[model samples]
Target: MDGQDEVSAREQHFHSQVRETTICFLLFAVLYVASYFIITRYKRKSDEHEDEDAVVNRISLFLSTFTLAVSAGAVLLLPLSIVSNEVLLSFPQSYYIQWLNGSLIHGLWNLASLFSNLCLFVLMPFAFFFLESEGFAGLKKILEDLDEQMYMITLEEEALQRRLNGLSPSVECDLLDLEQELQNVKTLKAKLERRRKASAWERNLVYPAVMVLLLFETAMSVLLVACNVLCLLVDETAMPQGSRGPGIGHASLSAFGFVGAALEIILIFYLMVSSVVGFYSLRFFGDFIPKKDDTTMTKIIGNCVSILVLSSALPVMSRTLGITRFDLLGDFGRFNWLGNFYIVLSYNLLFAIVTTLCLVRKFTSAVREELLKALGLRKLRLSSAPREPDSAKPSANGHQKAL
Candidate 1:
């Protein structure tokens, strides 16, 4: 009978774990589906005449805002569930009915808490960073378009110079016409510059949220770090192992959490500062040079490299190649690392590193040019040669005549 009871208890525990895991998975699915529908609506509602690029920017911005709200709210609600679990179990339950009632409430709280943390710390942060990156791409595209336009203007100017030197009777008129066209292009370029500046200013809307989240995360990380330090001090004092508050074992766990949080914070700051400065410099200079599009594929590739390096690749490589292996990874590779609490922290660190590296690479300029050659724009030298005859030069409207 004793053996049978033990077996039954084990079965019950296994079943309970399975149910909770399924519930958490389903909750995540539902949240993701909802976000999908929300983003789809924004895409469909965009105006028909709007530039495709503008519509894309709108969708990306909306997605990021929604992600930020959901992530912050979920993290904030984590404490409530934790409190319910600890406090509800201790309630006096002499009656079977009372015990069942408490158990149901506890279960519900756990489910809610689990869902919130998954959304907040994992899905939402990833989405937020992704959208921020899209914003950078949009700005970059605008700058490229500006460059192409300038190059075209330069080409027209060069052709006009050729006409003026060909001895054509219409050389004087061609010069006048080409100068007018160049002035018009310059005016349009000025308007584009203003638009770029406005877009940069609009990007500032995200700054407040970024700063707030950073501060909150920093506080949590500091608290955890302090806890881990206290634990280490207790261990060093050689007190009774059991009596040491947050014993060495628990302190080690705390230390792991601290490291994860600290890494996450560093990556986030790196992205925010780097992106802000990089984008600002691009806007300030108004340099128009063709650049490769840093599309979604590039971002994914960059993120994979970052995650591999920071999480597994570098650590494993060092261990295998070096003479010594340290406790650098903490408890990250263990089964407990998959626990809800552990995963929530782990995802943040992973996403931060990936997103930061990807954004930095996205903003890095690979090409530089002072003239827009692709758009037929090249620097021209003034020639004092005889003017072109009328039949060999362009018309007053800037259209070249048939030879």
Candidate 2:
């Protein structure tokens, strides 16, 4: 296409991309508002219960609601990105050629766009996982507190029962309200313990799985960035003589295509390895530790490993065997339907693994309380120790009790 025509097309593409981005931003805003509302509603409803467990449940519900909103936002933006790609095609041929010529300006713009798009995908999942992890952590704390509270109430009830039994019939009637309150507290405590167990299981499994996936995603992101840089290098080298500008090169087109293809292959391999590792980690370490704290150092190490492994593989894949796009496509063609089938199968497997981990954790937690009871570790009152029998004498008059 002529220079003028290319410029016109580029303008159109730019406008289209802008429109798509605006739509995406608007959708994100709407989703944020919805998330806030849902969390607020859950909190309000949860606050009505006076028990400690009820409070924890409310927090968990709020976190879950927020996560759902964030996930919805991410899914909504995926379509917007697809639409943006379509819009980019409307640019003029000359404008596109200029942009692809590897000028510093074009390179910077491309990098910015790539990172922005990646963030769009990564943010939602990160938010969902964060909320989930925090909710589970909160549930554990609440349950522990409830357990303590129940123990205290139980002890107080025992002591009060002894006193009531010792009292005259007329005096016992006066203590009925206190007795009823203690009973209600005991019931609430039991319910809380059950809920706590269930929530702990979810937290244990979900948090680790999410962390693994995030690490994989981080690696994928580095590979994507490397691919974009490689594509830019190839474009510069393959430019025709007459079209060559200050920043463009006159390298062999075949060599450029070969390098690009190699990079893509390395990317796919890294993705496969990452998927496997993520699946395995979740399955093996899905149990909750009572004192589990957020491991910032582990996260940092995981991210670094992901980057190094993927990045290191890139040069070896690109330079050693020199596989070109034609070669790669031919390899895939041999498998025919299996290629696409495997792609879908891999995704399904990952999903199944994650789901199973979640279910197992949930099941284990369901029986945790019963198991504890069977082990003679049933809830005990914090203050249940026997009081030293009346070290001070009882009041001479029955109307006054001893200190």
Candidate 3:
């Protein structure tokens, strides 16, 4: 009788899971079509001179923004599904499985949270920094250069004037050259100043949401780190074992969801690497807003490497913290690392080694410059459009509505 009861329960569970999956698929399809229709309605014509690059950038932008618009909402809503960190980044199986897992909300939340973290912490700040300091050094540096030139020019002019006799031909020529150069520098400086004033609004456009999401991500990271530490310190006898089976939430992801998740990771990796390089070369922050369309393939290639590197990582870290349920991964979530070695490798050793190397290379001028050169080449491909176009306004408006 007990055997029959268990079998019956399993059947019921699977049935519900499939039903929920069906509904989710329908919902996704509806949303996808609606988004496409809306975007097409607002789509504007491109420039005559606009190359393949603009087409690619526009496509990439729309696809990514549409997905992230979904995720931004998910980060706000689906976090309510979280019950405990006892599971470490996931809710317990069987407890909230029907809602969070059957429909894949928990996984979405996890994925969304990661992306939200990157946007709030890295990209948002970097965007502000980019506007403040692009094209011809910066306002302060330009001012200093302009002042130095004027001072030198004045000194030369006065020295020539002080000559006991009327100025020599060479002295007069020298003063003329200095004055002309100073006038040129002043003109350039004035134009740069006007540019800064124009972009002042963007610099001040710091969204409050950035800080809120940053706090959330920081807290989550600290929790995971702390949970892993406890796992290390607490004897196995003291800590409770994980409940339910592997992949309680993971399940099999659809192609759409997979693409969305991959995009999430790619965005994170690109921003991280680019921000680091920009800081290194310009000794300041890097551009976060889509720079150029030419770099599409480059980002894809770099992100592929990042995916492989972090592929086995975050999941195993969740394992170390003893996640009682899987969240975002699909079929890939079926495998969980119960052993300690994988945990150390994923959570501890990877960061340690990478940090050490970064630190070493950071102080070494030659290696640091070389790293910048290689990264800069990739950055060069992404040469940003002079400025976002007026026609993009409708798309941006649509995104605002979606968000």
Local accuracy of candidate 3 as per-residue lDDT tens digits, 1-403: 9999999999988987786667556654565566445434433333112344344434444453344343334322312223222232334445544454434554444444555456445543443344334323334555766899999999998888877466556878889989999999999999999989866543334322333344344344344445545555655521222333344334322233434333333333333443334443552222222233233322322332233233323433333433222343332233445433445436544543454455455447664444445334435555566766665555644653332
* Cα lDDT listed for each candidate: 0.42, 0.42, 0.44
Off by over 4 Å in 1: 1-18, 31-220, 236-294, 304-403
Best by lDDT: 3
Q: What tens-digit string does per-residue lDDT give for candidate 2 at 1-403?
A: 6999999999978876665466445655676578656445323332333355455444444434434443443232212222222233333354543323223223323333343334335533454355445555456666876999999999999888988788445557758977999999999999999999978775666545554554454444444444434443455332111122322222322333434433444444444455436543665433311112332222322332333333333222222112222111112123333234334234334544554465456547545555444444566524577665674546677544645
Candidate 3, position 164, lDDT: 45
TM-score of 3: 0.33
Residue-by-residue lDDT tens digits, candidate 1, 105-191: 345434444433454466445654555566655665667768989999999998888868884547788799899999999999999
Candidate 1 collision pairs: 166-388, 167-387, 167-388, 167-389, 168-387, 168-388, 168-389, 169-389, 169-390
Candidate 2, after superposition: displacement of residue 21 in Å? 3.3
Q: Which candidate has the highest TM-score of all?
A: 3
TM-score of 1: 0.27
TM-score of each: 0.27, 0.25, 0.33
Better of 1 and 3 by lDDT: 3
lDDT for residue 171 in candidate 1, whole number 0-100: 72
- Which is the winner by lDDT between candidate 2 and candidate 3? 3
Clashes of each: 9, 10, 1
